[model samples]
Target: MKPKAPNVHEDGLLEYLEDIIGYKEKQNQLKDKLSERKKNMLKQNKITKILKINMENLLKIIRIATIFRGERTIRFDEQDLIDLKEELSRLERFLEIEENELKAIQESLKDMR
Candidate 1:
């Protein structure tokens, strides 16, 4: 009996199956990465929330101490006030940076959709 020739349709079908498998693998990898990114974003959000609350509380305490001195006057010297102002400025800068980073991440996620 003569040798049989290879079938072109069978070869095409095998190639198509391999492509499908590759596509699915890539899709799964992307899905995992997206999940990780979302988790990271959630962590960042929590950090940002904590920072905001701390800043607000710090401001409130400063106001209450400085403005609402009733019996015993609290003495905050010039240097002390200056140091507190500097610390507040540092916190503000840090919060701004974190907020901008989070906003960029959110925008990128939106774009991916």
Candidate 2:
């Protein structure tokens, strides 16, 4: 014998099914968006860490060069000195920007707390 069809309900089951499907699709979309955002945040964190390390190394190099300049009477190549000076200036500017951003982040964290 053939099976009977499902009985129709007054509660509009078909509309409820459509709403459920729509809500599931929206939830899946939101999950995908959240995962993408998390990946981007991790990538940005790694880049920020690398930049901080590079800035620290640049500062150390500048300090060592300054110390050498003070200790030795040996004449350095003019081009080398000029290049070092330019690099130091660039690093200083970057450090200043990073410092400001770090302070801003700290302040934001404090506010959140």
Local error of candidate 1 at 99, Å?
11
lDDT (Cα, tens digit) per residue for candidate 2, span 11-109: 355546656779557656655655565565556556656666665676566567768878532245435445656665665565566556655655654
Question: In candidate 2, which residue ranges exceed 4 Å CA deviation?
Answer: 1-21, 71-113
Error (Å) of candidate 1 at residue 24 is: 0.9
In model 1, pairs of residues that clash are: none
Count clashing residue pairs in model 1. 0
lDDT of each: 0.61, 0.57
| lDDT, residue 99, candidate 1 | 61
lDDT of 1 by residue, 8-85 (tens): 444465456656778557656666766776666567666656766665676567667767765243455434555666
Instruction: Note the clash tally of each candidate.
Output: 0, 0
Off by over 4 Å in 1: 1-21, 68-113
